[model samples]
Target: MSVPVLRGMRWWDIAPVLDLEYELFPEDAWSPGMFWSELAHARGPQATRHYVVAQDPAEGRIVGYAGLAAAGGLGDVQTIAVARDQWGTGLGARLLTDLLQHATAFECDEVLLEVRVDNTRAQKLYERFGFEPIGFRRGYYQPGNIDALVMRLHVHDAQGTGNHG
Candidate 1:
């Protein structure tokens, strides 16, 4: 299999991204309007959002996508998803690394995210990236009434000398 390529997500990629999004998170997939709103702030010099998609070079299909929003020296991971077949392939890590890099570029001192409490796979991935659980949101995921684990990571400064915290 060819290595997937990672590139800034464009408006045209939403359809495929939504397909993957629904496939991975059928019960809580983001609506088209939500994606549109995120993409709206992804461009321009004053952009506060960064979104990216991973495409299979051989098939030219979107296999993964991730988004981040930064403001007030903080970054929040909006979403991250990888195709079932792509699981255990480090695609999630790559997507997250991209988001963290963008967070640093946005001058964010910390990054935050919420993951389904039942998603141990994703939790382990976040832990591998130095994230630590700080709290939980009860019944955060609707329709299923699943809790969410809130995690945070302290980003290193531009000089890479130490964490921004």
Candidate 2:
């Protein structure tokens, strides 16, 4: 697979994004309405959300996508997914890097995310980015009763670099 280019996700990307979303998280994939709602706040000066799609330039296809929501000096990772075949190709890190950089732009003091307890792969990715396991949400994933591992990453101002940031 070719290296994908990350660009701002648009309303039209919903259909393809949903395809990947359902493929990656069939039991708990986000619906088209959910994505539409997020994109609704993703533009303009008052924007509180940042969403991006990783498009493989050669094929002009969305290979991955991610989103972040910011408010009250805090940022939350809403979602992050990469094509199965693209796993271990560092696309996940690239997508996450985009979100964290945007988090700083939004003046966020910290960022948080939740991963299924069984998703050690995702947990490891977050941990590599200095996300610390803060807590857990019992049965957060519906239809399966899967627990969620909550992780937090404190953000330091751009001018200064912390051990984690």
Candidate 3:
């Protein structure tokens, strides 16, 4: 199985990323304007965010994407989505790895994220990266009213936190 190419996300990639985003999270997909806002803060000397897209070379399409927001020694995993067809391709881990690496770059002391309570797949992935649940947000997800599990990872404790692909 060939790996998708991972690169810094650019504005042109948002359309394709949004397509995958809606497909993966139909109930709570982020609007284009929300993405635009995030990207607006993702560059230059004042940047505090990192976003990326993974494009399948053979398919020439975005198969996955992830983003990180950092400020005041904290990094938040804003989003992570992988095409349904690419579930077992290690793409999700690859994307998360990118975010964690950036968290370290941003001088973060720790990273945090919210995952749906039912998303054991994602929870396991975070556990593998040394994230521990700290709390929960009731009804954090819209439409379905799903609760969110808040997890945190200390940047210094995550294995290979400084490595990037």
Candidate 4:
């Protein structure tokens, strides 16, 4: 499959994004209102948040979506999800790479995220990108009270030190 192109989210793209979001996160999917709020953050004055959707160029279908929020030199991975059919096809890695690039663009010192304790696949993915578990959040997830592992990835510049600027 051709690599899906990543681009900014638009008003018309919400339906497909919503579909994928619900498909991947059925129990914990964000509401349309929440997506709208994220869009606001993506376009707000601080303008440090990025919301991107991966799409099929031939048919314009959304295959995945991801976002990151940069605040005071920290980039928090707000979310990332890919259609089940597209999982393990490098789509998730590509989306994550894009989000990390966005973090670098914002010059964040580190990136942070919380993953369900049971999501070993996701944890492995994050680990491959240098994220290390530093703490835990009890009952951080909903519907089933899943615990979360707080992870951090420190970014380094050519100097090999934390990139905080």
Better of 1 and 4 by lDDT: 1
Q: Which tens-of-lDDT digit does each residue in 31-133 have in candidate 2?
A: 8999999999999999999999999999988999999999999999999999998998889988988999999999999999999999999898888788889
lDDT of each: 0.91, 0.92, 0.92, 0.84
Error of 3 at 63 (Å): 0.1
RMSD of 4: 3.8
lDDT of 4 by residue, 1-165 (tens): 667898988767778889888887888888898888788878756787898999988777899899899989999999988887787887877888889888888889899999999989888888878788999999988987999999998866322332222
TM-score, candidate 2, is 0.94
Ten-residue stretch with the least lDDT total in model 3: 156-165
Note each model's CA RMSD in angstroms.
Answer: 3.1, 2.2, 2.2, 3.8
Least accurate 10 contiguous residues by lDDT in model 2: 156-165
Error of 1 at 123 (Å): 0.5
At residue 25, what lDDT does model 3 achieve?
96
Clashing residue pairs, candidate 1? none
TM-score of structure candidate 1 = 0.94
**Deviation (Å) of 88 in candidate 1:** 1.0
Give TM per candidate.
0.94, 0.94, 0.95, 0.90
Q: How far out, in Å, is residue 152 in model 2?
A: 0.2
Collision count of model 2: 0
For candidate 3, lDDT tens digit of each residue in 1-67? 5689999999999899999989999999999998999999999999999999999998789999999
